[model samples]
Target chain A: MTDTYFVAVDWGTSGFRLWVIGRDGTVLDSTTAPLGMSRLKRNDFDRVLEESLDKLGIAQDVPAIICGMAGAAQGWCEAPYLCAPTRLDALGEGAVSVRGATRNVHILPGVKQMAPANVMRGEETQIAGLLHAEPSFAGTVCLPGTHTKWVQVKDGAIQHFETCMTGEQFAFFSQTSVLSHSMILDGWSDNAFRSAVRLATQDPVAVPRRLFSIRADMLVRDQDSATARATLSGLLIGQELMSVVHYWRDQSVTLIGAPPLCEIYLMALDVLGVGGRSLDVETTTLAGLAAAFHIQTGTVHA
Target chain B: MTDTYFVAVDWGTSGFRLWVIGRDGTVLDSTTAPLGMSRLKRNDFDRVLEESLDKLGIAQDVPAIICGMAGAAQGWCEAPYLCAPTRLDALGEGAVSVRGATRNVHILPGVKQMAPANVMRGEETQIAGLLHAEPSFAGTVCLPGTHTKWVQVKDGAIQHFETCMTGEQFAFFSQTSVLSHSMILDGWSDNAFRSAVRLATQDPVAVPRRLFSIRADMLVRDQDSATARATLSGLLIGQELMSVVHYWRDQSVTLIGAPPLCEIYLMALDVLGVGGRSLDVETTTLAGLAAAFHIQTGTVHA
Candidate 1:
């Protein structure tokens, strides 16, 4: 059994994940919690961190590297944002060390694009892991989530990126808005999804006006809740696709998110006659954290 | 003093307005309440109506004529939608009488379109009022609200229309979404609103992608809460404007809504280099109710 080298943590907005790295620079053990910075204070973070360490029987002296909203100003401490056109190979260089934590915790900085005004935290670490796997890869990387990110990479650097509130809007429309009464959480319709995606892709401007159709169709045509749910998903993703046509058109594309979410995005892209590959978010997140550890410490993993 | 004839009620989703029509066919006395169909049960509506009639010391024998969300299926009683290509001068033809009410309460039916699957409740009454004022009015009638309605009128009938959830989106963005922390309820930034509206009109597809900028601009440029709020408003209205360009472009436009809301739409139209006329909503609702009263009862007001 090797000594723990460090702990890699992905402390996101609504959840937390931790991994103990052995001296061989591999994950020895891991744990996750529903701890997020949005509702908890710095003291809560400390308590959670201690509990997580105890869960893995890791010693107090082992350092930790964290990413995501844990770095937000409203989070544990302000890690601040690294401006865009940023290089991917050395994201850990911008890590901000938590001053009064239980251990030496360094929070990775997020990235910001100024003109169109966009920002992201944890996604930067994933991009770093991506560069580690394909250093020369140059294309569009789409990471779909509540706030989906579209990153343009060239020559190991992030050229530009944009964030769309597609997932959040979907949740709002289907859960809180007038469409809520007509939506079914457990139902789906692929054909409905594909048709909506195609309509939205072709006439993106009509989306705002078209949203009420779900309610109207439910009243008049008795549109299925499953079909309504799929339409909602399709319209959001399709509208997002229209904004990023320039990024994805005639370019190699990769999607990094939960499989189900990525599957939906992939299906949306298929509607546009575009193709892309999907990467598991957790795997890339861990790889990105490991890559950061190696890149910053001048250490190589087996 | 003329004898009371009937009560004209504009019962909306969130508020209520009423006018007592005299035997001479003009407003005799009036009162309003915060009554709305969205929150109250059908029995609650009966109680409110009775109370409202008592407020003005009107007799139980006096009938009531109602419009707006009171006609929704979830309303007092189902005032089933009157399908479109609906005639503007005779909307009362589709009125559904409230069977068990204290008096002869008639809830005017809303209008529905099949192919695009759109529906409107209260706005049709406003349109009827517009036709009363301008009997041969042709072109777009824009009624801005939580769900702003764009109605096309020609040959004394509603040819087509669409609904945009602009105001609702603004509410969500400024009060419920990530931009909530950065928004000020009493803020005003006309320049920011104009700029955002123009951008959205030109590229509506980018609205969803650009929403995060309110948060980003607040983070990076320290964008003003007023500016952030106005930008949010601009983006939503701009996106809606893109969808209705064909309706407002190269046409006579009349905006019928609350003065403040209509002012915003007028400004947006100005940004598009288009001109429109705004009507006070309360006045129009009264005129609409009166028009329905006259058209149905064949009585003329002096």
Candidate 2:
């Protein structure tokens, strides 16, 4: 009962995850619910938070630190974006307090890039986590998702970043476009993925053309569904790499996301002769929230 | 009744266009039905054909010439794809006969490219139409649509051709992807479209990056949906042009498709300083069908 020191929450758009941390930064206990920000209104947020804390058997007085879409405009309480060139350590300073909650609760801020116009809700904390682990870390970070993010970090702040719709684009074409009619939804091929990435790296701008080739291969050349599916993934990721290949090709790269998706990115980077490594999102998010919790609520334990 | 020389039908995936031609290759009557190949089972095709012919008040003895998806493997009767370098004039030579029908019905063959694997069901007829108008027409033609096609025509044969799923890709991203949430479905911006096309041509592989910008622009830059929609179109078309720009850069390109779609292609082509002209798809389809009727079933009138 005394092991729990603080509560950490990663409340995303579709999923909610909470962890009870000890005084020395260990996970004492954890729980998860499908109650993401998307499922709750302003009024329901307090109830969900209280229920989550109670379900974990944590003391009501234990302060909570939250990140992700829970800080979005449509979330519990908008933690307005902290514009980029934002110091990773200073994220705690921008945390917005939940109104009328029994315990002290803070939602971390997102970062918005004004030029080229991009935004990230939960990733800023992950960036903080990276810095917490390697305060001197300097390089580019790639986060793969439906809207994949490519961020540049140097010194102690997020200097710049760009978002690519490659993942979503791949999904739409594979599942909803005319190409869907010619594909086997469950089949895949690694060779096809590698070959496509190589082709995309060579002609970068021609990925869209190769997309039609996927359909044509089935219609004319007897290419199987396995090859088609992999080729689709490779073409999209390859196209994305081309935009930043010049910058990332010569630098050390860190990919932080789910391992399966990150592996594909690493494989693609290898095709371009670029080097990179990955960190799991769960570790980073927890580290990030803990950092913010300590900075903003240092007296909670005292 | 005397003006009815032969019946010509353009049966597509979702559209059925029929034209009744005169002895001198003028349209005597025409009709269209919503019953395209996609909406019917194989057994329903002959009935649709009979009903369509009867609806047009044409005698069964008049005979009928058909093109497009009606010749697809899934359509009425499979008129197998005529592998490429097959003479466009020989499209009629490859037509397959339908058995036990009241009239002598023939379905024209589509063109298929083996390497890079591509096939076209209806555009070959449009190419035949181009040759009928200018038998010596030698250059490239761009037909933009759900599956936009680029063909290299020389000496009345489709020397080589490539299909770009650009239109469909744009539609999916604009309407189905995460970007759709930030866009205005009905608004448009010419400048936005032109600039997007120009930028895409400048950095062909980066269109996916620009897609995220459309959403970010709305969220962070206060950009309107009008610009967002046009940029989406331009980015896709621009990427498509990048694939064929070198071969097409110095040639006299012809844009053949529905006027609205062709205009977008022509506008995109102009951005690259590539000089090209357009031909109405309807005009070309009719001319091609009449030529096929005269060559494949000349005895119908005799």
Candidate 3:
């Protein structure tokens, strides 16, 4: 048996990560770098990657697997989007060829949707990881993050997905909009979160009015900044809740991803009366890459 | 002929103004400063008035009258809001006894609508000016500014008013929102303005989705920053147009205030097919105060 060190990389827009794993699928070592795609040109990918690995005392000959936005057209390479009903075995194994690297560097493909103009990168791995963690699940699995993806997994295959701007809109309104000054940098308000869920659930039609009130209440009435944050969170989340009510009406949801993000969606789900459970798909991207690797290497785990 | 110089003052929240005028309402001299109500304590009205006069090289004893937000609760004094169907002459007339100023400083009351939670402080004078400029004019008078006021003046009386947050929303979105980076601050695009008006008129439902598209287009397709500005303008102005469509549907509009503000409203009015004329009620605050002065003192035209 030729033992190989496979590096799993999750490179986002802001940072890069590389985890070296043994044949036994345990992380032997890991390394990270601040060289994100946002700061690099099309040609600088190889140099940056080599330098990142060199910093971690890793040789260039290590076989690797990459995921996330690093494979976008503007990233290291453009990874084609995987279509629906795609299983772990269906993701064809290939490597993005780079010079002077003795080992193969495979990049995972993302997913895309035409309607409502939505796309996702690197989430496929996470979805694959979800499937790996729960080999036989049948429900709407929501991966809520920067670009929230609600994927329908049933009969052991990825059926379809819809992307929501809930996360991005929240960040935009919180940090970029006038509501920023009113929202505290840190601190959780379940009261706000719950009220937001209620507002979204009850008077969803009044979203346009509520958005302005978020600022007006703070500036004119001198409402507490904390309340403003809560109100704002509620407003955006509420708006999203309204937008996606039809999807959750008769479906069970399995929420995957971080806690806070999942918690917010869970609250909305509770308000929406969608019976669901949240599962922390541990290191989903790694699991996804491993599944894809196993499917390619003809390793049968069953 | 009692040649008492009729002083017209445009006193509002931000500042106070005193215009020394001949009996015919021809200004002899005028002065203004930042002695707005914000700097004044409850009893400091007298001192603030004196200071404003001193800045304008006017005597503290100058006979002056004021209008606008200066009479609100937080102002130098709380001048009550007058209800609709009230003539200019029916506004509260009383002498506020400010110490150290020989002239009697009378503050004008603002107009309020209790049912819809709306109020206009400074525009009352402008509305009065519009009425004074065009008495026997029965139609809609659109005062387009920071808080765009669509006021109905019927049968030579201020009938009703509603304020839309057009200008302020524009400023907030243009500067604070994600659209800020893309807006061309040097000048505005009339084409963008027209398109926005058309969009608002035709499909008012798509405004919110279109707002998000600005970011997506910029990021994915590398759209111009200028498109962001026009798009925002379209969304907001379209929203404003939609909001005040009822006012413009069956009536002609007389746009009051400065040129640019009037132009946008005029554009919107044109879109609504309301035959309108932009009446530059230049220095409306002064003219309003002058008319108020004439009404109070029973001064004949010189």
Give the best candidate by lDDT.
1
- Comparing only chain A of model 2 with the true chain A, what is the TM-score? 0.95
Task: DockQ each candidate and list the results.
Answer: 0.78, 0.74, 0.14
lDDT (Cα, 0-100) at A91 in candidate 1: 78
Question: How does candidate 1 score on lDDT?
Answer: 0.86
As a whole number from 0 to 100, the lDDT of residue A190 in candidate 1 is 95
Model 1 regions lying over 4 Å from their true place: none
Model 1 chain A lDDT-worst window of ten: A293-302
Q: Which parts of model 2 are misplaced by more than 4 Å?
A: A33-44, A47-62, A100-103, A299-302, B1-3, B100-102, B299-302
Q: Count the backbone clashes (under 3 Å) in each candidate.
A: 0, 0, 2
**What's candidate 2's DockQ score?**
0.74
Model 1 C-alpha lDDT per residue in residues B185-283, reported as the tens digit of each score: 558899999999988988888887889888989888898888988888999999998887889888767999889999999999899889988987777
Tens digit of per-residue lDDT, candidate 1, span A1-302: 88889999999988998999887867899998998998798778888988989988989999888889998988998887888898976577778878889888888889998887888999988887787777897899999888999999888888899899888899899998888878855599999999999999989999988999898999889888999999989988899889878899987579999899999988888877789999878778887888776666666743
lDDT score, candidate 1, position B72: 91
Q: Which stretches of model 3 miss by more than 4 angstroms?
A: A1-4, A14-22, A27-56, A71-115, A134-205, A214-226, A279-282, A289-302, B1-125, B134-210, B217-229, B236-302
Q: How well does candidate 3 match the true structure, expressed as C-alpha RMSD? A: 6.3
Q: Could you give candidate 2's per-residue lDDT for residues B89-160 as a string of tens digits? A: 888778889887678899999988888788999999999999989999999989989998899988889998
> Cα deviation of B287 in candidate 1 (Å)?
1.3
